[model samples]
Target: MRVLHIITGLKAGGAEQQLRQLLRHLPPEAECDVVTLTSPGLVADGLRADGVRVRHLGMSGNRDLRALPRLVRLIRAGGYDLVHTHLYRACLYGRIAARLAGVRAVVASEHSLNDAEMEGRRRTAGVRALYLLGERLGRVTVAVSPTVAEDLRAWGVPRSRIRVIPVGFDPALFRFDEVRRKTARNFYGLPEDAYVVGGVGRLIPGKRFEVLVRTLPHLPAGARLLLAGDGPEKEALWRTARELGVADRVVMTGERPYVPDPGDDAPGMPDLMSAMDVLAAPSAMETYGMAVVEALAAGLPVLYTAAPAVSDLPADAVPTAWHVPCSAEQYGRELLRLYAAHPGERTVPDVVQRNSIQNIARQTMDLYAAVLSDAPLEVRPR
Candidate 1:
């Protein structure tokens, strides 16, 4: 089957990384191509290296109407069997373009319905109307977590049209390695005996990285904090670290490049997780906690705040993940306990099996087949 994926951009974000991983595990019979509304960033090269054709629309900004017609033309010319869209802007434009191109099958995935937006400025009729319009254009809307699906339903997307498909990761790649852990720590110049607490994601307000920084002062003397990822809030986070008097203990590795080279011996997400003593996810909201899952896969105990993706699982699936309050004090207390009683190897076989990229790709392919065969504009819950 021929499929085309449309995304806002090919940056090194969770959704972008998930897309790349999914494509890598797609069945051999599936021919996939990607089109980014904006310029392709780090993920483009890796996708191309994996033999996936990626195109940039060269959109100047959000107001670029020319991209619509160009996208429609491309879809029509490619004769793709399905159009899969990711992110907000991509969903809005890709669905419309696919319909204009006479494509019968179109699907979109909702990676986040951030709590701040849902309860803040975005809780208005206009946003809901636009979302409903875009959802109506697609055959189905995939929710990365059940929590996101509930939010979509609240925003007027019919429950029947929503499918809960958690994002996947490769366990083999993220699994723990003692050698890589030592090497990553050495490369980062972390002291051998330092107790590292790590967080990974965009340095945004919603992530509440400030809370993690504040927790540093409460931690033991050798406890260090590492935040891997970058965003507009980086400067603010640095300022917070300075004000909290833990600037020296905080390490901000600005957006790590996405290099999927297996044998390259370079530090990646796996190595970074291995270097940490425990992973802390203090985000106010998350549709699916990709980093939490990855940390668990790498054999690190996790202290997270409301990770539906992890919490929704059967308790046995993520035994090492502890749901804690989104407070620096609570997190500090947990860290002390974890430091005292080191969390041993707790590999979640169930989580690894359920969230494998190959499994997710096959499930997604099944959804495509079902959508094509049924050809229902509106579906009823199964």
Candidate 2:
């Protein structure tokens, strides 16, 4: 089974990282390659190191009329059995290109779609029209969470065409270790007893990380807010911390240089998770709460505004995770309350088990087989 994955870029964002991880877990019998429309960066390097062929199409931006034909030619030349598109830009262009290249079995994954916005941009009418148009060109559309699947259905997508496949994490990489925790804390210059509140994922305005920064001054002096990931909002977050007179209490670690490649010396997301006492996701909107899931796998307590990844399950399913409003005062109060309770690493939740990469890869392979043989696309539940 030869497949080609096309994405907007190879930057270290949710969709890009998920694509890399998915490729890693795919069956060896299924060969895969990647195509990035533009700005291939850290994830691109990681994919190449994994021995996957990656091609970059320098077609500029959304209005790049030249990219369509270029992508079409590449699809025709590769003669892939199926083409899977990730992210918004690649979905639109890739679906059209695959059709033009005579490839009928195409699939697209909607990684960052929420009700009001997508990938931090507000969902406009024009965007919806274009998305639907592109969506029709593909045989199936994968939604990372049930919430996103509902969003797609509300937008007029047929229920038969949408698939809910939550993203997965390797439990081995995230299991808690006292020695690793101490080492990671020392690596980040965190004190042995400090109450660390971590915010992971791309530093974007839509993430409401500023809410965490604002909550810092309300917490005890020993409390620290460590934000991982990098983006245009980094400088602004620092300014907010400084303005609140808690600059010393806030640590902004820019983009980690490497991904979660086994045996890599550089500290990855799991190390950052280990260095934290609590994981806080301030975003009110989320397609799937990957950070929350990863923190749970690492056995850290999570305070999140929205995590559709765990929404379908019972509260007992994720006892360590609590829903908190996306406000500085609420977050501050919750953190202080939880701190007084003296929480530690909890067992990995059932949600992680349900979304394991092994199971997801098997389901995906089933989808590919069905699509190839003209079978009805079944919408499997989590």
Candidate 3:
């Protein structure tokens, strides 16, 4: 089986990481290549180094009219038996291009929810029509979680065409390790006696790092905040921390020069999570909470903001986490309360197992086989 995986970009994000998992776990009999609608980044560069055929379409932004012909040409030239797309841009273009190129089958994997598309009749109407076209052209669609599957149904995607495939991470990379924790903390000059609360993300405004910073004052003086990321909002976040009078306790590591390979389950950074007393993910919006799961895998409890997008985590997993109200003051109080409980017993392992990558990959490969079995036989390219 020849499969082409299409994505908007190769940025280091949950969807990109999942795509890496897909490429690594695909059966050897299946030939896999990746196509990016924009310039590939660190993740794409890594994939190519590992011998995956990586193609860039050089499209800019959402309104790239020129991408269609280029996309069609690539799909036709590759003679792919299947085209699998990740995220919206890829899904929109890949399905259309696959059908235009007369590929045997087209499939899309929905990694997270996009609320902006569902906010109104205009976007909703356009999306519904697109999905209808996609449902006919793309033989199957995969939702990363049950909640995501239900969401697609509500948005008018045919229920018959959608299936739930849980996201996964390798357990080996996430095993608890104390020595590594100590090393990471010491290397970064984090106070050993202090309770460390940290978060990881693109440093975007929606992530609510300010909320976490606001929570710092409510906690004990020994508590400190560490943010691992970089974005347009970094300078402003730094300013906020300084204004809060906790600048001394704030450490922004900026973006690491190199992140973990997509195949790696654990982040490349010193397992700082293991050293952390707690992980705070107060994002006002997050679809799947991949970072929350990663922290749980590292045996650190998580605190996420109460949002519908974060509702996918199972109830059992809630015990290991704290969901705070969206308000910064209330969030701060809740975070401090948890910190006071210090090393509270929680089912960190179970939550991690539920989101492990190996199980996710196994289910994905099964979906591939199922989709292929039902797919029409491929015709020779004209």
Candidate 4:
């Protein structure tokens, strides 16, 4: 079947990363294509390397209507069997374009939705109306977490139309390797004996990354902050580090791919995780903490403020995952405690396998089949 994936820009973030990872796991026989409505950065490059056809629509902004006809034309020409849309802009335009192109099966994912926010932006009445209007044109909507599912319901979407499908991680890729740990540290120019504190995500304000930077002052002399993604907040984070007098200790690896591109020199997510002594997620709110789960898969003890991926599971299954209040002092205290206690001989937790990408991929394929056949989702959410 020919499937076309549409997203708002191909920048490296949770939603974009999930799109690439899901496509990578799909069957080889299924023809797939990707179109970015705007900035086609590192992720676009990575997707193309994976042999996925990618296009940039060159959308000037949110108000650009000319791109709609172009997208419809491309969809019609591609003869796609399914059109899956991600992010807000893509959902609104791609759904309409897919319908215009005569595609019957359409899928949209609500990757970010919490009590107060959607897509990292504060929720508004106008946004909700627009989202609902576009949602009606699609057959089904996939929520990345139970919280998002509930939010969709609250947003007036029928419960029957929403299926909760948690973000997934590849367990095998994150298994801790001592050799890889050494190599990754060497590659990143990290000192062999430093106590590295890791945080992974787009360096956005919602993520509260500055909390980690502020915690640097409270940490021991050899402690370091290693951030794995990039966004508008990069320079601000550097400025924060400078003011805190720990700029040299803060290592910002701009926009590394979670699933490595085959020939790329930059270290992949797994290698970076292997180099961390502990993973700190200072985000005040999260829908489904993909990075926290990835850290658990790497056998790193995680201290997080809000992570549905860790919290939704039974406590026994995620012993390594600890919830902390959103504060630098708390994070610093937790870091010191973990340092003294000496956690993880690189032992992965049981929860890692629960949200395994293989299982998620199968569920996703089942979802696609259900939508295509116009059947109700018999979702087995893990």
Clashes of each: 0, 0, 4, 0
Candidate 4 deviant stretches above 4 angstroms: 378-382
lDDT (Cα, tens digit) per residue for candidate 2, span 196-302: 99999788878899999998888889999899888989999999988999989888776653355566565777788888899999898888888888888888889
lDDT of 1 by residue, 221-298 (tens): 899998989888999988988998988988887665445454545577778888898999998778788888888788
Alpha-carbon local distance difference test for all models: 0.84, 0.86, 0.72, 0.88
lDDT of 3 by residue, 134-209 (tens): 6677877787666667777777776777877666666556556778677767867887887888888778877788
Measured with C-alpha atoms, the lDDT of residue 331 in candidate 1 is 90
Q: What tens digits encode model 4's per-residue C-alpha lDDT throughout 134-206?
A: 9999998998888788778889988888888888778889888888888888888899889999999998898
Candidate 4 has what TM-score? 0.96
Clashes of 2: 0
The number of residue pairs in model 3 that clash at the backbone is 4
Q: Give TM per candidate.
A: 0.93, 0.96, 0.87, 0.96
Clashing pairs in 3: 168-356, 168-357, 169-356, 169-357
C-alpha displacement of 314 in model 3, angstroms? Answer: 5.1
Ten contiguous residues minimizing lDDT sum, candidate 2:
257-266
Report how far residue 125 has shifted in candidate 3, in Å.
3.6
